[model samples]
Target: MKRIITVESVTEGHPDKLADLISDSVLDECLAQDKRSRVACEVMLTKGKVLIAGEITTTAKVNYIEVAKATIREVGYETEDIDFECRIHTQSPDIKHGVDNPLEIRNKENTIEKDIYDMLGAGDQGIVYGYAVNETQNLMPLCVNMANAITERLTFWRKNKTVKGLMPDGKSQVSLSYDGDQLSGIVSIIVSTQHIAETDLNELREQIKSRLINDVFPEYDLSRTEILINTAGSFICGGFDADTGLTGRKTQVDTYGGIARFGGGAFSGKDPSKVDRSGAYMARYIARQVVTKGFAAACEIAISYAIGKAQPTALDVVVFGECKLSVAQIKQYIIENFDLRPAAIIATLDLYNQKYKPTAAGGHFGRPGFFWET
Candidate 1:
C-alpha cells in the first residue's frame, strides 16, 4: 500500500510551547529546591500578560512572576509588554491523603508484603502509552524525527544569527512516502518562520534551502521533495503578541507525533508522583527495550493506574507484525525484570533529579539524555 504520513513540530517560541516551557520551568524550580515537592503548575499566555494557576505543595518559595518574566526574556521576547499574574494554592488534602497512603494499604487488602517503595500511591488514575519504531536511529518514526530536526534547526539559526532576520516562532512539517510498510522517501517539507520587516521573502526562501535544510539533512536526497517556505507569505507577528498559548496544547508534539496513541494526560507541569508522567516514561522504557531486544520491530505499551492505588490496574503490549516471543512471555519478562510501580519508576528513571524545561519544547521521546531514552 502506498501512503503518505506527515508530522509537524513547532519551535520553542511558539505560544503553546512557551506556555509549556513556563510550566516546566516552575516544575524544575520546585524540584531543585525540594526533591519531594508536588507541583502541578499550568500557564496561560496572551498579549501583555502571563497567568500562572495550579495546585502546588512545595516549600520552594518561588517568585512566580519573576520566573515567568525570566522565561520570557530567555525566549527572546524581552521587548514585549508582558505582565505576570499568579493564583497558586497548595494541593488539596483529599488528593494528598490518597497519594500518601495507597488504596491497598488503607483498605488492608494488600496481598503482598508492603515496603517503603509501595508506600506512595498514584496521584491520579489514567492510562498512558509509549511507542517506538525502527525506522529512525533513535527508534522513532521518521517523519516526526525529521519535523523535530527542522524546527530545532530554525531555533538554532535564530539564536546564532546564522540566517539573518530570523525570529523565534516557527513550524516545520514533513511528509514521507511509504511503499507498503517501508519508507520510500520524503514527499514534501513545509517551513513557516517569523522574520523582521526588512527581510525579503525571496532571500529568506533561498537561505532556508541552501543553508538550513542543507545543513540539517545533508544525507537525505531532497532534490525531488516539494519544499514550501512561508506558505502564508509572511509571519512578521508571532508569540504572545499575536496569539494565545496554554499549557498542554501540544501533547501530540510532546510524545509520538500521532504515530501512536496518547492517554490524554499531559506530561509537563506535573511531578513524578503523578502516574500520568511517571507511568508514561516507564511505558516508553519498556517499549524501547522490547524493540531494541528484537522482540518486535515496533512496539507500543499501555499502562493504566487507579488513583490512590500503588499498583497498575492493567498492562498491555502491542507490537507490529510478528514477534519472536509470545505476548504473554513478554509480559512475564517485564514483570520479572522491571518494576512498573509509580515510586519505583521515579527511582529507576531518576525523574525527580532531571531538568524538565528542556523536554517542554522538543519532542520528549527519542531524545538521548533522558533516562527513559536509555
Candidate 2:
C-alpha cells in the first residue's frame, strides 16, 4: 500500500515569516539584555507599514523601530520603503505576579526559596505536542527535512550571490511516497521564488533543477521527479506588499507541517517562560529521546498545563504501535527521567540565553542547533 505525504517550508521574506522575523529579533534583543525577560509579542505587516503590538516586560532599553528595520533589511526587504508603527504595552502586573514570584506558602515548614520547584508554575494554560520518527537520520519526517533543506539552500544562494536575481522570498514543498514503513521515492517538488523582473526565469529553473535540487539530495534519485518553479511569472511583487502578515500565522509551517497534531499555539516572540514555547520544546526533547533509546521507532507526545500550576496537568504519549514498551510504561519512564515543570524545561533547554531569529524563518522542528532536535 503506497501513500503520499507532503511538507513545506517558506523563506524569511515570506510575508508571515517577515512578521516572525521581526518578533523574534525583538525576543533575541531582550534575552541578550535580560534573560528573565517575559515577552508575548505579535507583529503585523502590510504594504508600506509594520505594526508591532504585544505585551513585554523586560529591563532592556531597545530601539523597537530600528530592530524591526534591521530585521526587515536582513530579510532582503528594502527597509527605507516602509513605515513602522509600534503599540507595545507592558505585561500585566497580575500575570507577572504569578509568573515571576509564583505561589508561595509561608512557615508550613520553613518554606525556603531554595526549594523553588514548589513555587514554580506554568506561565499559561495550554497544550503542546512533540513528535519524532525513525524514517530519517535526524528522526524527522523525510518530506519536511527535504523541504527545509531546499529553501535553506535557496537562502544561501541568494545571500552569497550564487543564484543571481533570486530574491529572499521563496517556498518549497516536497511530497514523498511511502510503501508500508519505508519511504519509496519523491513524488513531486515545487519551488516558488520571488525575483527581479529582468532575470531570465527559464535559465533559473534549469540552474535550480540541476544544482539546487539535485545537489541537496545526493542519496536520492530525483532526476525524473515532477518539479515546478514559480508557476506565476514575474514575482517582482512579494513580501509584505504582496500579502499582509501576522505573527504565529505559520504555525503549521513552524512545526510538523501537517504531519502531526499541534498544541494550537506558536513559538516565536515568546520567552521560555511562555509554556507555549518551552513546553513544546520539552515535549520534542522527550519524544526524540524515546526513539534514541531504542524504545520506539516513532513517538508523539502531548504535555498539557493549567494556569498557576508548576507541573503538567496531563501527559499523553503514543508510540504508534512501533515500540516494545506500552504507553503507560513509556509515560512512567518519562516522568521518572525528565522534569516537565516550566522552570525545569527552561533550564534544561537553555532557551533564555539563546537566539530565536533563525527559528522565526525556517521551520522550527527537524532543524539542527535547536536543543529539541538533539
Candidate 1 TM-score over all chains jointly: 0.97
lDDT of 1 at 246: 95
Weakest 10 consecutive residues of candidate 2 by summed lDDT = 104-113
TM-scores, one per candidate: 0.97, 0.95
Scored against the true structure, residue 132 in model 1 reaches a CA lDDT of 85
lDDT of 1 by residue, 233-338 (tens): 9889999888899999998899888889887789889999998888998998999999899898888899999988888999998888668888888889888988
Off by over 4 Å in 2: 101-114
lDDT tens readout by residue for model 2, 255-314: 888888778788889998888988998888998999888789899999998766677889
For lDDT, the strongest prediction is: 1
Off by over 4 Å in 1: 109-113
